[model samples]
Target: MKNVYIETYGCALNKADTFIMETLLEKEGYKFVEKPEDADIIILNTCVVRLETEERMKQRIKELNKFSSNKKFIVAGCMSSAEPATVLSIAPNASLVGPQAVERILEVIKSSERKIILDGDKASVTPRLFEGKIAIIPLADGCAGNCSFCITKLARRKLRSYPLREIVESAKYAVLNGAKEIELTGQDTAAYGLDLGGTIRLPDVVSKVAEIDGDFMIRIGMMTPEQAMRILDDLIEVLKNPKVYKFIHLPVQSGDDRVLKLMNRKYTVDEYRQIVTEIRNKIPFVNITTDIIIGHPGEDEEAFNNTILLMKELRFERVHLAMYSIRPNTKSASLPQIPDSIKKKRMHIANKVYEDVAYSVHNEYVGTISRVITTELGRKGSVIGRTINYIPVVIKNENAQLGKWYNVKITEASFYDLRGVLV
Candidate 1:
C-alpha cells in the first residue's frame, strides 16, 4: 500500500471531506501516513474563508513542498477552487481539486499526473469516509447567499443538496457504527432542500433523522438569518424532537443596520433579535450562538457600539468572533478597510463583553443536572462533552468513555465551559 498524508483546514465540512478522501483512498490500498516526508502522496485540504487563511494555506504548501520534493501533492477544498490561479502560482506542480470534485479523488490519485481536478461530481458513496462514535455529515455544498466578505461563494459555486434518502441512510449508518453525535453541516444548513425546489426542507430532513431511534444527538449546523426567517416555523416544529439538540447557531454578522447593509447582509438587527427572541420563547433552555465580524468596512464607533449593545441584550451562549479580513474578489475588499489596530481594539472590547455576559448567564446554571455527549476523553481521564444546549462540560472521571451520553451534574461554571461530574 502506498502511504498518503492529508492535512485539513477550515470548517467541519472540510473536515468531513478530508474523512471521505481518507476512506476512499484507503479502500484503494493507500495507507495513511502521519508526516508528509514519509508519504508518497500528500493532500492539503485548504480553506479560503479570509485572505489570511488563504495566505496560510500557501505557506503550508511551501513548507510541504520542502518536505516531499519527490511526492505527488494534491490541493483540494475551498482555496483550491477559490483561487486556482494563485494556488497554481504557488505550486504549479501540484494537483488541485474542489469541494464538489471530491468523488473523483480515486481517479485523480490513480492517474499519477499533476492536474487541477474541479469536477462537481455528486457524492454517491453510501457510507461516509470517517464514521466514528461521532460523525459530521455535510448535507450540501455551496451556499445560497453571496455575502460581501465571503470567498467561499466563489469556491463553492452553487447550492447542491444531497438526496434526502442518502442523507438519512448515512445518518443511520453512523449511528449503527456507535455514533452518538451527528453534526449536520453545510455552507448554510438551514437553506437545505431549497435547491431541490420544495421536494423537501431542512425540517423534513431533521424529522427523518430524529425518527431513526438512536441514543445520539444531532446538531443542525449554522443558519443564516434569512434562511431561518424563511423556515422559522418549520424549524421550530422539527426542533421539538428530543433527538435533536436544543441549539441553533445563526451567524448574524453584525447587529448594526448600517454595518449589515455595508456587509451585504439581508436581515436587519431587529429581525435577528426577533428570531432569537422567538426561538427562546418556544424552546426552553435553548442555546443560541452567533458569528460576529468586529471591524467590517464602514463599521464606525456607533455601529460597533450597536453590535455590543445587541450582543449584551441577546446574551448568546457563544460568539465566534473574528476581526474582518479582506478577501480577494470580495465586494467589501475595495471599501474603506478598517485598520488592523482598530479592528483588534474592537475585538478585544467585544471579547470582554462576551465574557461578562456568558459568565453571568452561566452562573444561573449551577446546581443543574444536564445530559451531555462526551466527544473527547482528555488527558488523565478527564472527559470533555457538550451539553444539550451545546455548552462544553469537562468531567473529571476516569471511567468516562467518548461518545457516551452521561448525566453530568454541573458543580462549577465558567465563561467558556462548564465543570461537571458525571453521575
Candidate 2:
C-alpha cells in the first residue's frame, strides 16, 4: 500500500476540501501517515489568503523537498489556482491541483509526471464519510463580492451553491457516522443561492440541516454584511433553533464608511451597525465574533479612531484582527500602501482594544452555569467543550467522550477560555 501525508492550512472551507481529497485518496488504497517523512507521497493543501501564508507555503515546500527527494509531492488548493507559477517555482516537479479540482486528486496522484491541472469546475456536494466527530460541510465554492484587497476572488471567481437537498443529505450522513458538530462553510455563506437566482437562502439551508435527526451542533461560517442584510430576519429565526450555535461571525473589515467604500465593500458602517444591533437584540447573550483589518490603504488617523470607537461600542466577544499586507495583482496593492511601521502601530492599538474588551466579556461568564458539549481533548488530561453560545469551557477530565453533553458550572474565566466543572 502507498503511504501519503497531507498538510492543510487556512479557513474551514479549505479544511473541508482537504477532507474530501483524503476521502478520495483513501478509497484508492492510499494509507495516510501522520508525518511527511514516513510517507511516499506528500501533499501540501496550501492557503494563499495572506502574503505571509504564501511565503510560508513556499518555505514549507522548499524544506520538504530537502527532506524527501524520492517522494512525489503534490500542491493543491487556493495557491494552485491563484499562483500556480509561484508553486511551480518552489517545487518544479510537483503536481498542482486547484481548489475546484479536488475530485481529480486521484488522477493527479496516479500520474507519473509533473502536471498542472485547473478545472475551475463547479464544486461537488457528494456525501462522503469523514473520520471525525466534527464534520465540515462546504455549502459552496467562491463568493459574490469584489473586494479590492481580496486575492481569493482570483482563485474562486464565481458563486456556486450546492443543492439544498444535497446539503441536507450530507448533514444526515455525517451525523449518522458519529459527527457531533456540523460546520457549514463557504467563501461567503450568506451569499449562498445567489448564483441560482435566489431559489434558497443560507437561512433555509441552516433550517433544513437543523431538522436532521441527530445530536449535533451546526456552526454557520462567516458572512458578509451585505448578504446578511438581505435575509437578516430569516437568518435570525433559523439561529433560534436549538441545534444551531448562537455564534455570529461577521467581518465588517473597517468601521469607517470611507474605508469600507475604498475596500469595495458594498455596505456602509451604519448598515453593518444595524445588523449587529438587530442580532444582539434578538439574542442578547449570543457570542458575536467579528473580523477587522487595520492599516488598509487610505486609512487616516480619524478613520482608524472610528474603528476603535466602533470596537468599543460593539464589545465583540472575539476579534479576528489582521494587519493589511500587499497581495500581488490586487487593486489595493496598486494603490498607495501603508507604511509597515504605521501598520505595526495600528496593530498594537487594535490588540490593546481587543484584549480589554475580550477580558471584560469573558469575565461576565465566570459565575454562570453553561451546558457544554465535549468537542475535543485538551492539554494535560483536560477536555474542551463549547456552550450553546460557543464559549469554550475546559474541564480537567481525561475520560471525557467526544459528542457527549454535560452541564458545566463555570468556575473561572480567562481572556481566551473558561474553566468549568461538570455538574
Candidate 3:
C-alpha cells in the first residue's frame, strides 16, 4: 500500500478536518506515515490565520518541493482556498485542495495530473471513529462574522452549521469508541444555525449532545461576544449540564470600543464585559478563557491600557495572546498600521500582565483536591488530565490510565498548568 504523510496547522477545526481526511484516505488503502521522507504522498493541511502562518505555510510548501520530484505533494486547507497563487508559486506541481474539499482528498491523491479541487461543503461528514481518547468534532465549517482583521472568513466564508442530529450521533459514536473528551469546534460556534434561520441553535445542539449516553466531557469552542449575547441565557443553561465543561473561550478581541469598532467587531467593550460577568455569575469557578489581540490598528496607549485593566479585572484563567500582523486582503491591513516595535512592546506588557494573573489564578488551585480524568500523556513523561472545568493538571504517576477518572491533589502550580499527584 502507498504511504501518505499529512501535517496539519491551526485550530481544532483544522485538526478535525485532518482527522476526517486521514480516515477517508486510509479507507482507500493509503497507509499514513509520520515522516514525509517515508511517504509516497505528502499533504500539508495549511493555515493562513496570520502573516507569519502564511509565510510558514509557503516555506513548508517550498521545502516540500524538493521531494516533489520523487513524491506526490498535495496542499490543502485555508491556504489552498484563500491563497492558491502563493501555494502554486512555491510548489507548482502540488495538487491543491480546499478546506471544504476534504472528502475529495483521495481522488486528488489517485489522480495522475495535477488537480485543483476547491468545491463543496463537506461539513456533514460524521468523522469516523477517532482512535484517540479525545474526539474533536467540527460543529460547523465557517462563521457569520466579518471581523476586519480576519482572513479566515475569506477562506471559510459564511456559516454552515452541521445538522444537530449528525453532531449528536458523531458524539455518541466517539463516546462508544472510548473517547473521554468531546470538543465541539467551529469558526464561531455561537453563530450556529444563523444561516439556517434567525434563531441560534447552539444551545439546542449542546443539549442534544449532552443527552448522548457517555462519560465524556464536552468542550464548547470559541464564540464571539455579539453572538454569545443573543443566546446567552440559553447557552448558560446548556453549560450547566454536567456533561459540559465549564470552560468558556470568548474572544474579546480588544477592550477599547474604538479599537473594537475599527476591527469591525459588533459588540462594544461594555457588552463584552456584561457577557463575561453574566457567565461568571451563573457558573462560579468556571474556567473562563479568552483571546486578546494586542496592537491591532488604531489602538492607542489609552486603548492598550484599557485592555490591561480589563485583563486585570477579568482574571482570565488563560489568555490566547496574539500580536496583530498584516494579513493580505483584510480590512485591517489597509488601515494605518502599528509599528512592529510598538506592537512588540505592547505584546510584552500584555503577556507579563497575563502571566501574573494566570499564575495567581492557578495558585488558587494548589493545595486543593479535584477529580480529574486522565486525557493524554504529557511531555516530560507525565500524565495529563483535566478537572471538570477543563483546568489542565499534570500528574507524575506513571500508573495513571487514559480515559480514567481519579482524585488528584494539586501539589504545584504554574502560569499555564498545574502539577498534581493521584490521591
Candidate 4:
C-alpha cells in the first residue's frame, strides 16, 4: 500500500471531490500520509476561479512535484480541464482529473504513466465527508451561466443536477453521521434541474432535505441573480423552514449596467437590488453576502463609484472583494483591461468600506443573547459557532463542545466574528 497525500483548494465542492477520492483509495488498501514529503503520491485538487488563484496553483504544483520519482502526481478539478497546457508545462507527468471526471480518480492514481480523465465520466454519491460538525454535499456540477469573465464554466461545462432522491438520501446519511451543518453546493445552485425536464427545482430539493428529520442547518450555495429570481417566491417560502439558514450569495460583479452588459452577467444592478429587497422583506434577519470584482474591463471611475454606492446601499453582511486580472481565452481577457494599480486601489477602497460596514453591523450583536451551534475549535482555546442567522461567533470558553447548542451572550465584536460568553 502506497502512502498518498491530498491537498485541495477552492470551494466546498472541490473539497468533496478530494474526500470522494480519498474514500475510494482507502477502500482499496491505500495508506494516507500526513505530509506530502512522506507520501508516494500527491494530489492537488485545483481551482481557477481567479487569475491570482491560478498562479498560486501553478507555484504549489511545482513545489509538490518534488516528492515523487515515478511522476505519480495528479492534478484534479477545473484547472486540469481548462488550463491543461499550463498544468502540463509545469508538471508534465501529472495526471488530470477534471470536475466531471472525479469518479475516475482511482484509474488516474493507479496508472504507471501520466493519465488524464476530463470527460465522459459520471459522478455518483459517495460517503459524505464530515469533520467536526460540518458536512458538504455537492448538489451538482457545471453552471448554466456564460459570463464572459468566468473560466470555470469551460471546465464544468455540463449542468448535471443529481437526482433529488439521491440528494435527500445523502442528507439523511450526513445527519445520521452527526453533521450539524450541511452545505448544498454547486457552480450555480439555482441552475439546478434545468435538464431534468423542469420537474424539480432548488427549493424543492431544500424542502425535501429539510424534512429529513435532523438538527443540522441547511445552507444554500451561490446562485446567479437572474436564475434565483425565477424561483424567488418558492425559494423564499422554503427558506422560512427552521432548519434552513436565511443566507443568500448573489454576486453582482459590478453595479454599473454597462460593465454588467460587457461581462454578460445577465442581470442589472436594479435587478440584483430587487432580489435582495425581496429576500430581506421576507427574511429580515437574513445574512446577505456578495462578491465584488473590484475591476473588470469597461469599468471606469464612474462604474467603480457606482459599485461603492451600491455596497453602501446594500449593506451586505459580508463582502468578498477580488481584484480582477486577465484569464486566457476569456472575452474579458481580449478587451482592454483595467490597470493593475487601478484595480488594487479600487479593491483597497471597497475593502475598507466593507470592513467598516461589517464592523458597524456586527457591533449591534453585542450584549445580545442567542443560541449557537458549536461547530469548530478556534484559536487560543476558543470554540466557533453560528447563530441561526449564520453569524459566526467565537466563544472563548474551553468547556464548549462541538455539535452542541449553547445559549450565549455576545460580549465583543469584530468584523469577522462575534465574541460570546456562555449564558
Maximum-lDDT candidate:
3
Candidate 3 clashes between residue pairs 3 or more apart in a chain or in different chains = none
Q: How well does each candidate superpose onto the true structure, as a TM-score?
A: 0.96, 0.96, 0.97, 0.97
Compose the digit string of candidate 2's lDDT tens values, residues 145-189: 999999888877778788888788888989998999999999899
Clashing pairs in 4: none
Model 1: clashing residue pairs? none
Better-scoring candidate (lDDT), 1 or 2: 2
- Compute the lDDT of residue 30 as modeled in candidate 2: 88
Winner by lDDT between candidate 4 and candidate 3: 3
lDDT of 3 by residue, 9-75 (tens): 9988899889889878767778988899999999999999988898888888888878999999999
CA lDDT of each prediction against the hidden true structure:
0.86, 0.88, 0.89, 0.87
Q: Which residue pairs collide in model 2, if any?
A: none
Model 4 misplaced regions, further than 4 Å: none
Tens-place lDDT digits, model 1, residues 256-322: 9988998888899999999998999999789999999989999999999999998899998888999
